[model samples]
Target: MHPINLNEPATTRPTLAESLSFTCQLGECRSELLPLLSEVSKVVSGEGSLSKTLKLVLELMQKHLQVTRAMISLYDASCDQIFIHESFGLTKDEIEKGVYYPGEGITGKVVETRQPIIVPVIADEPLFLNRTGSWDKTVDCRLSFICVPIMRGMKVMGTIGVERLYNNRQLLYLDLEVLAIIATTIAQAVELHLLERAHKQVLQAQSARLDKELKEKFKPANIIGNSKAMQSVYRMIDKVSHARTTVLILGESGVGKERVASAIHYNSSCGGGPFVKFNCASLPESVIESELFGHEKGAFTGAAARRAGRFEEADGGTIFLDEVGELSLSAQAKLLRVIQERCFERLGSNESIKVNVRILAATHCDLTAMVAKGTFREDLFYRLNVFPITIPPLRERGNDILILAEHFNAWFAKEQQADVPAISTPALNLMLNYDWPGNVRELENMMERAVLLAEEGVIHSYHLPAALQPAVLGELGEQSGLEARLSMMEYELIVEALARFQGNMSRAAAQLGLTRRMLGLRMAKYQLNYKDYRCGD
Candidate 1:
């Protein structure tokens, strides 16, 4: 296909149909139109995507028709302009320059009026703007431009246009008819493409919302405690979770020290990375070094293959050392080195392996005493204790015992596929009286036993273990007379229920299995004002 030389002097040229008639017969225009439309139909209805189908449609127009260039422009509501969506025989720079406002040029006029336009000679028509630089504007050019609005019903979507060399006005009108037919086919394909793009945007929005919900479920605030002591712990967790600080969690055994460490790790910036846990007291001193610092093959008597330690496994994440004070002095020195340099050499290998990790250590022992006695290194102790958080024992966490008991009861009942039973007043009194030496761990185990042993839908005092029976209650309870003990127990239960409900009388009565009148009478007998337990407003 030769390009029309726009720089040539104005001269007489044969019409397009006259040129074709010299090569072929006279009545062959319908035969040419039929095959071109059929090829365009096959390209439009193909299983290819919108972008691919549009590209082939433009290319087919240039190939089967005697046109120098073909293009499909689409209306962009975002910018309120018509821009060339796809084109053939035009460079990328030229295509970028093909933009027009509504009714600005021949293509824009077709879009605005929703009609086809034919320019018998481009140089003679001032509306045929050569904005794409496909031809020289300073010379007489015998090029014809035909543009048809791509429409759906009465609305115009955009325009499909072509540039050709034609001298006869009758042949230019015929070219306009061919462009109109192709524009109709393109309209259907463009409609489907818009629908698919809208559906994809909806799916992307839904996926983002679900991702946010899942992240909220694992946040530190989901630990489930409303006590003032626990609130302080939550504040500490929130502060440390945003940094790379080494944290030392101090708490008694069974006080959920590991749980606090887990909360910090999951809420941190590196929450997506691995979280590796190791128990320093679980292994013997002889193999503790090999376990903390990965050992190479044949490093020890029983060592068979190379292995990665918890520190190496926790690269770009966090490592939790439980009972950290139990680490041997030799292992402590190696841990101190890793904390200082962020690198460590495996046992039996001199090659140092670098790691990027945050350390979180927990211990129930007195690290200061151990450091003074030379059992634990002072340098290592200081490194691990940069940010210390102590979780209070369950006995010290006032009303949280009842909250935790209810949570564990519901959890275990779900696990066993049994109905959740209500803890009776007698059983509640026994729990509040006893001192939980084993902390939350002891309460959790007791609740599991109580839930399993409970008959019907109520957990009575007899359903609890022997340690929580009347004989044990007598030793921990008021030790006054029987009536006095009952009255004091009644007062304590009312106060706890009101505090838990934040002075909501209705909910407090529901939890205590009493009516509004009965709860009010009890509150009066104890001289308790519900307003005293009200928080905020």
Candidate 2:
């Protein structure tokens, strides 16, 4: 391929499409057409995107084909719809109304027949719809119109068109051949765009569907948390839901570590299969192997009947080994073999029984330290750590305590028909101050007790659990760490202080025991203004 000067008019250069046409007449175009194609070859060989390639095709056609107006409509292979993607002469309104179905118009006919259409007069062509409204009631009464089908093998994807200003016998066969070559260029560009759009749509649909299905199927009744940290864990569940990998759920005790493990398995590819749960800490060192790997008839002293092990039962699914750090030395070695080879033998059966399942292990104990102490297999740790999702505890995630408390409180109120009081300022203060060691699971328990004790809609200071409540019910406690709680509070104290002072700068500063400048910095950090709280401050 050689270069052609793009600045020259279209009639000067012979198009490659014109070379392939029977009607094209060649006089003096070979020299001009060859260099243009060479430049085209260089550009088309660079970035292989739909937009770039379409622009290239239009440039090629404009250089060689002495015709009026051109357009490329692409076929969305998946949707079976034709849409005009790019055009040079069509008005914006014309383009908006440019969608074509098979056999509907001249373009449609070419697409339907997988052949070219040569209408010397567009107005004379029977299939031409002339969309009068699209072009302000003015029909394209061109004397020479040519439409050719663009094909990917036998399937017609789109059509490219070229029309001469007037019907003339003087137009050479080489010109039509050049237009045909340009039409082929349009076809290649359409294919690339269609494929790219299809890939993006497929990925988007998969991601959305997976997220929706996970929330519906895997939500356990006992698990509770709407905090950002817990939502982060939920998003991880959505991401790894369909993946085939080892998942390690890490959290402190009473943090519903088992609940997180269940969500993972139920959302995974092995969701339809059995969920085999085993407490590694509860099983004795000698029997842990038989319990996990299963025993055949007479495999052990108490092997009264042929029993399938946890692994065998959980085949084609997930095996949740809770407290996995407590596995003894021998058990860790056997487990490592299962992780590496995915093959394990029953206690009595010498025949190797291969299990097809995802491994989900949970631990309240620190496995990192256990790996350092040589109590746990480092290889097993790495294998299961493919996706490690941690459930953050209550102490770090503030406000989640209130959200979960309100949820569980509502549940308990409905269950027992108790008239639970609204949370008092003092009780809320106590709640905000106390460090909940038990996390969301603990907050749920406290709410249950509060709902039971409260006599009214308010869960007052009296309704709070002993651990969370100050001894003096009526008064806010001095040693209750309310000062420290206010210091750590993000926005509530600043808002309340500003409200009490009626947003007067000096008064609000005096109320908060801060300089006006210090108060401003706090206001900036929280994005709060006293004017925001006031009807008219």
lDDT against the true structure, per candidate, is 0.76, 0.67
TM-score of each: 0.49, 0.47
Model 1 weakest lDDT span, ten residues long: 1-10
Question: Mind giving the per-residue lDDT tens digits that candidate 1 earns over 72-132?
Answer: 8987544568888888878999999999988888878877777677666778787777788
> What clash pairs does model 1 have?
none
lDDT per residue as tens, model 2, 1-537:
001222446587445444434233434334556555566566654544455566676666676654457777776657666677776667878777877777677777777777776665556556667542332224556556667777654557787776555444335334455556655555544544454366446535654564575566444444665555776787788788778878898998777788888877776777889988999999678988988888888887889987778888888988999989899878888898898888998888888888897888988878889899998888888987889988787776666566566677778888897543345443554676678888667777888887776653445554566676433332332335655334333344565456445577677676556899998887876555667545443
Best by lDDT: 1
Query: Model 2 Cα displacement at 439 (Å)?
Result: 1.3
Please list the residue runs of candidate 1 whose C-alpha ends up more than 4 Å from where it truly belongs after superposition. 1-222, 469-537
Lowest summed lDDT across 10 adjacent residues in model 2 is found at 1-10
Compared with the true structure, the alpha-carbon lDDT of candidate 2 equals 0.67
Off by over 4 Å in 2: 1-224, 419-421, 470-537
